[model samples]
Target: MSADDKYPEESGRRRFVKGVVGGATLAGLGVAGTVSVQSLTSASGIGGGPVEAMTIDRTGGPAPYGMPQVPIEIDDEGYIRGVWPEVDTEEVQGVEVEIAREELGGLQYSQEWFQYCGHQSYEGLDPNFDSDNYFKSDSAPGYDWQADVKDEGDRFHIDDFDDYEEWGNDVGNSGVGKPATATWRSEDTDNVIPVVIIRSSRMEEAAQESEWLDASTDEGVFAFVNKCTHFCCVPGYKRTGESARYNAEDRVYCQCHQSVYDPFNIVSTLYIALPRPQD
Candidate 1:
């Protein structure tokens, strides 16, 4: 049985969040990396209750964003392979090769970055499914997002490469500028992952300097799991309207709690809860 099947009340994602903030001690959870609870609580002041909170203290100079390290393995070919089975190995390898050889900038929008895996469509998903029902809010934005997907005869064929160049390369477009997204399915697991590729103008500049490239900058290509770390919500890319945030660039926004995660530096901060209030 899958981890989710064994733990019906809480999926792996929810359990992880709970261990961090729901008054559970972190000593034996076997979480991937080390993160100091004191650092997170001292930085964000997200104390009290069983929920994990993050606030950008605009008035408090710079809010201390602690980097949460995600363990990643690189092959001899410079491909990024995650320890988790949900990761798409072939896709990530191709991307890493392109980036290492500096051929990523020449890639067309119709390339592998925009290919959708044919496991299932969001429309066919049950909103009440365990994966979708974990959010605290009743209104799951994914439902509306699925509805907004233009029908292309086949539900699995969600991506339209015809306008990809115009939407991804054109900076003036109001929608997510310079980014393309697609969905991928893992053969080893039931996880349906969403991937986004961002083409930044800074890539050329960074390439010329011979310095380590920043994933958020123009000189890099980044791909990450679409699941929101906060509540396991599948964040929509470039979504607009009252329910969505205006993401003009390559960013992931969770509609449930309006949690914004930068795919480029997602590991930069770890959010942990302080000691639980005395009973």
Candidate 2:
């Protein structure tokens, strides 16, 4: 058959392949099937009788459906490396991220999903991320954690750190209980996005004993890519025998060159390569 005869349009073929392969990939990784934005039942259908005087199965009042909830955890390295109740992708529409630092009292980062709700014009956005800048580890060396993230689809996106300089914030805010607002200017396009921040400390608590909406064993499946932004190296965390927890006295060990970072302020270039400068 001719190419045009077999495929009437380019999108016709691409759409078919995307649909078939997407499900296969998700299933192989044990990811729950994606949910749609459709509603299950109507509120008006409840609370009425069948016949003139029959209460039949309609003997009900106002009721709500409680969807099953799942628990997940975040590790010391600041990763949510665990399974979770599949969330509605529409939820990608609105996400609240809370990142707390220093005994859950310092740096409260919050970004309501409402900002990115409607369609946006991404013209001139930098998809290449070449113009993006990294906040040197020395600037915020008080804590050290890594969050490595990757995805097959556009499920994840990055923001340039330069855009948020006015707010006095930076990335690497994914540590245990340190919440910092993340700003990324799309390299491929001209768009800036914001997300709520929550770090790994809460995960430790959730792991010890599950409670509240944030506690879940499966949530632990995810982990943050905490490598040094410059050399792409991993930093060590404070062990039990360390000087003290989350204090400058405690340091984040860099294996590449025995470099130690104070976990209470910004990082320092005592021995290893220097970290990128913060805005």
Candidate 3:
């Protein structure tokens, strides 16, 4: 099915949101609100939410899927060794690395599935459930649920789908219409950071207004933390006019409470307003 068919119209979005709210209440959980930076980092999980043990597809046999080594060289001290426009030297204490288009094709896109009906199972949620294996470590032998995310991108391309046409078709179990994400280790802090990259043709206006340093020069690559400023639920990207929460244009949307953010604008004002309930 096309994205239009998969993602409902505005009215349909209202129903979906309503269903989600009702389901959460039934499950004895409340919607999360704004959160602090400290709390966000400490959560160590996806969007400061609980981590669930997910099953892996050991059947396919593990293919090579980990942080690919980039041209950005890291020194023995773990600092990036070159100067690039994409990196903030002050932040990383080394040369900033710029992610090239070719590199993006090799990187794995992050996926997320929402099943608000309380029906819990790996099936019907994710197609490439094993794509998230990178989040898990050998020492920790389970799915790192916290690792699945779609929020910010640094010198990274953010879009509704990781590979627009491919993901739109739901190939490789790519969570089409779901938030697509990628991650890299910052040479500066030596921390693995998740980012959302947008290359949508329709997001020019929003990108011009974003906080991304290179938004002006780059093709709308703005990176930020994947956590929602409010309550920290992993917000997913919705294509322009896909749902009621994103009635006008493309945006980052929080399923928890229907909070909508502009993918093009700075994160501070991205939260334009809350979606109004249908009367």
Candidate 4:
């Protein structure tokens, strides 16, 4: 207990001072309330929104120009699904789909598309299935859309209906009608989900063009059914090769679990059997 021992060495005193100063500096910054950089990166963590929230533009309805909408198909029941709309089944009919299996570099590869994969149609709706108020297509000309489509005859195609057309139809036909849920792979990438087209029976009924129109009333029913068991996902329907555009061989395909269903017959088991909500 000497005076030198009680006073401690100069070096020890300096160390104590430094520690105290550092603690005070940190306290002034409110370290307890400060957030970590790692937490900001996480979605549910502290501070501002996560990385996706930072990058996502949720200000208005459609995203800013040049920003991809991140392919997401929301079904009538509000489920995330996928679908392809490349081929209009009403335009193509009575097709045969083929499947080829190949192994490359020790990796197995299966070729699938609309006709061969499988499909579910949203039929029993109305003529001009394309025409609807909620339907939005940036690609189609003038966007001739409709809530319920009007049969314009064989000379007309669904693609011919644009958003503007739909808007006009919406004005003509009031009330909010639900849009058909569809999903499909992006033609932009190979890894993109697979999608196909189901040729509509209406195409076969083309022979009955006279039946489509009746002198009874101005409003007529042109039945267009979508066989997709799931509401929101895209009906697997497309061709793989250059010759497959409008390929009759393509079948229904599921991009989520790589399930392939037979568009023609009732498939109890396929890739992964998910519950199909009854209509």
Point out the worst 10-residue segment of candidate 4 by lDDT: 53-62
Candidate maximizing lDDT: 1
**Model 4: residues with Cα > 4 Å off, grouped in runs:** 1-135, 138-202, 206-235, 239-249, 261-279
Model 2: how large is the Cα RMSD against the reference?
Answer: 25.3
Two-way TM-score contest, 2 vs 4, winner: 2
Candidate 3: tens digits of C-alpha lDDT, residues 102-174: 2122221111111112111222122222122111111211112213332232222222224443343211123
What would the per-residue lDDT of candidate 4 be over residues 159-273, giving only the tens digit for each residue? 3322212222222121211122222222222222222212233223332443212210111111112223222333222312211221212333333222233332311121211
Which ten residues in a row are the worst by lDDT in model 3? 56-65
On residues 152-244, what C-alpha lDDT tens digit does candidate 1 reach at each position?
111122132223334432222433323434333222234444444343333334445532233222223333445444344555445534222
Worst ten in a row by lDDT for model 2: 54-63
Highest TM-score against the true fold, candidate? 1
lDDT (tens digit, per residue) of candidate 2 on 42-113: 122111111111000101111011101112244454333222122222221242212111111121111111
Which TM-score value belongs to model 2? 0.20
Report the lDDT of model 1 for residue 235: 54
Ranking by TM-score: 1, 3, 2, 4
lDDT of 2: 0.24
> Over all chains combined, what TM-score does candidate 1 have?
0.35
Candidate 2 residue-wise lDDT at 6: 17
For TM-score, candidate 1 versus 2, the one ahead is 1
